[model samples]
Target: MLTLTEKPRRSPKNEQLNSCASSFADYEDCIVGFMDDLQLVHCGHDKKCLGCGEELAHLTLRGVLRGSVGVIGESRLAMTEKVVLLGGRVCAVKRFRQVSSGRREFGKKIEHLARVSQKCEYLVPVAAYLYAKRIKQHGHTALDWNQRLTIIVQIARGIGFIHEQYPPYEKKMQMNVHGNIKVCNVMVNTDFSACLSGYGFTQLAEPVEVLNTGQLMKSPCRQQENTTYSDELSQKSDIYNFGVILLDILAGPKGLEMTKGVKEKKASMKLEGGLEFFEFYVKEGKERRQVSKVLEIALACISTKPDARPSIEEICFNIVEIL
Candidate 1:
């Protein structure tokens, strides 16, 4: 129900205005969509913000999100009745904080993964730039447990691309892990293909300048510096997490059983005195072998020692080859 004037006042968000200008130059139509936090309306077609007059609209929200998408930590996922520019098919819009460095480097990482996508056939690759959300809430929510009842999370070809493009040595040594691979961080296309989405957790052990000491300190950015090696992250970490994701997609303890496991683990992690379920997978004898090869892979990747794991490339190759 928003109104537009005859003379067309300068928009506060130029991207929205420019998109409308490009699409409906002669039509002079006032687009009706949700405004972002910056009070800019994203037209979605060309991303021209109708509030400000800027020609930067590559990353803007179109409308309120629908379907089983929601926030998982700092990320947001939602299915919308809009089309992504890459393939122009109706796709779910996902938003998360860009990698710690900046958007340009992150975009380059996506581009690098896309450039060699043909080599890998098992993973999905992201196809656009990462940008701040233009729309505040577009009414999006996380996927409910009952909604994804089948536990069938779709992984895209991007992982395969990463696995394939990496040199065998790097693959064996450390194919560059998907540091925080999880169900919420993956994307599914119309074709049921799955792709990795969150790379913000990926980090390198870099030196930081200590102002007081005037010396460089090596800082490995994993949670508590729990890295594979001296400031190095390996693909095995990704392999391990991916295996967990596969477990979630395949079994995931479903229903009341899922809730029960959750409560128990929550208590255990908090030292509130509960059964240590994480140790359940480490049982010896034939019982251990009965726990599904997939689960075993997950446990192995999550082992305390970095050197005691298989690389992501090897893991992906094994999954595609074995199962």
Candidate 2:
């Protein structure tokens, strides 16, 4: 038995942490889980690290991962949307193109990657993955107010869980979190529940100096020539994206186009009390109040300043309160 009284820190590359994971399959329904890097995290965190158990998918399992969750910088893997297996079980698959790691090494990496993020129910579990390849939601706004609201809450909890976990190994200093959270990428399962997909896949788009009101750029304090790629990948940027999608759900596509210069703090206060801006429909004051709570969340998520955005944990907590 090990006798160190202190907490277990991330073990060095040469040493593997104790394996605590069983399997990645959540067989209850059609819902998949949150997409994240296969990175290991210390178990002490709110979401324990996924254990290093049977997470490997061999070339033999090829064609299984027709679609992948997301990809890293050059880790560039091929991707598809989804595939239905022999048993009527549909799965998301991702195949990698340029991965140079051998079989055993690749398995080790996947096993270590998710040991910390396996516990969140909001995150759909991976039944299996085949490395033979390489590599990764929206649209839930049309249902009744209750269904729409439930999806919004589920999404908030999923992203919140992601943000609560530490930034992945390569992202700690660069500070990338979720980086991508839009509507088309939000997956709805057999039960009609929602879970965020396409997480952590940082965009390689050019640094944008100006963004639409719907996609607010982080407020800049320094007068710099341009924002770098790393600068645009923070949690605040993700919040802005989430806000845009939320607006899309409430107001539809064309509505957000006119949101040119709405003031954040002022607009938020008005929205929480009423849905005057979006023309939403709710049966009673209580129902309206509950839905408006989400409107407030969208505003906070899209705050102009990075420092002004609420942490994911706060957003999740607020969503839970509304329920």
RMSD of each: 14.6, 15.2
- Return the TM-score for candidate 2, rounded to 2 decimals: 0.55
Per model, state how many residue pairs clash.
Answer: 33, 37
Task: List ranges where model 1 is wrong by over 4 Å.
Answer: 1-73, 76-99, 102-110, 117-121, 128-160, 164-175, 189-192, 199-232, 253-291, 313-323
Error of 1 at 76 (Å): 9.9
lDDT of 2 at 233: 67
Q: Write the per-residue lDDT of candidate 2 for residues 190-257, one digit (tens) a residue.
A: 46577664454332122223322211111111111121112366777777777766666666554355
Summing lDDT over every window of 10 consecutive residues in candidate 2, give the lowest-scoring window: 215-224
Native-referenced Cα lDDT, model 1: 0.35
Q: What is the model-wide C-alpha lDDT for candidate 2?
A: 0.46
TM-score winner = 2
> Cα lDDT of all candidates, in order?
0.35, 0.46
